[model samples]
Target: MQRWKQYGGLSGLFAAFLAAGYWGFTATGGALPWAKRSSKALQRGIQEGGGGLVNLGRGIVVAGPIRKGGMMLEFGGLVLLLLLLGIGMYVYVDRYGGFGDGERASR
Candidate 1:
């Protein structure tokens, strides 16, 4: 019972931290918030430029500025995703013993 409570508390704390960071960064227009704006900018760039994915014959080539912004967004998102995944895996391993009882049945 105590272990369950600890696990629950940890999970809640992680969630709250993630939510706060996302909201705070977005509100402050930080680098992380650039991810959302990238999609819109990509569309506009395609519309203005003569090259885009849809026009496969010419091959897709995003504008230099838009591409640079997108790379930053992608890198930031990758870091966040990796962080969450690592935390989740750690929680799972902690909740259920990673190396289970090997040969203690007779004991």
Candidate 2:
């Protein structure tokens, strides 16, 4: 009999990725209190067009810290997925013998 053990780790990793993306996007402009400040700062900067607005807008983008964090989160998720798959394969092999028919035993 072939035994298949499903690893929920991948799902967990996917969820983490989704959460990180959500936080990143929402942090820029969501229900979060800081989002309001960020939005206002961005708009004001765009309007001013000069030093004040330009600097404010640039500061907002730079201060957000989303780009680098997002990349790290994505990489972490990928690693989690790989780890889960590896563990699942290991469990499957340990329980069901090898990858060939020879692994199966006659009843």
Candidate 3:
């Protein structure tokens, strides 16, 4: 794996993901609807809501868009996946070591 090949592959993957994300955004009515809903929610909350910032009784509340759009499961799954990936990386680096001074000095 040459450096150029690695960078090129990453660039291609990024472009593909960007295109897919844009397509999905366009197909799903773009950001207009979301922006409108967010503004309305903000105004309504300001006018009619007053409570402690952190309510332990209520537990965790998902964002309004994710909850209302029925994507809570997807959001949760993504969060779990990322959390596992992060923990796995941390464990791997702790056990096998990363780019430490010894490794860098050899190079």
Candidate 4:
């Protein structure tokens, strides 16, 4: 029983580490594909407009500085969410003993 408890604690810690690593990798990796797609779409929208007044308006809203700013905001939000999850996981592991604290210690 005692041995099993120790193993359980270690396993929990390992699981927490794995979860954090996966979340970080996916969040960082996912941003690149989205950024590329957004850039391409913006470019297409700009080219299709062909320098007319309509194009100018479309360009301002979709393909111009606003689009760039929106992308930055999205990327910033993704990074912030990942950071918050990481901090939450760290706190969870710290307080919960990863697996579960021994019953005797809880009192």
| Per-model TM-score on C-alpha atoms | 0.29, 0.32, 0.52, 0.30
Say which prediction, candidate 2 or candidate 3, comes out ahead on lDDT. Answer: 3
Query: CA lDDT of each candidate?
Result: 0.75, 0.70, 0.86, 0.76
TM-score of 3: 0.52
Identify the superior model by TM-score, candidate 1 or candidate 3.
3
> What are the clashing pairs of model 1?
none
- Model 2 clashes, total count: 1
After superposition, which runs of candidate 3 have C-alpha atoms over 4 Å from their true positions?
Answer: 55-107
**What are the RMSDs of all candidates, in order?**
11.0, 15.2, 6.5, 15.0
Model 1, 1-107: lDDT tens digits are 69999999999999999999999887897885687788888888789875345666764554577667768577668768999999998886666655466453333
Q: Name the runs in model 1 displaced over 4 angstroms.
A: 1-3, 30-57, 66-107
Per-residue C-alpha lDDT of model 3 across residues 30-64, encoded as one tens digit per residue: 99999998899889989997676568998566777
Q: Considering lDDT, which of the candidate structures 1 and 2 is the better prediction for this target?
A: 1
lDDT of 4 by residue, 17-103 (tens): 999998997988967888998999889978886555455545433345545566867756876999999999888877775646565
lDDT of 2 by residue, 1-107 (tens): 22332346667788999999999888777666777777998898789774542465364232335455666566568769999999999998778776877846442
Q: Candidate 2, which ten residues in sequence have the lowest lDDT sum?
A: 57-66
**Poorest 10 consecutive residues of model 3 by lDDT?**
98-107
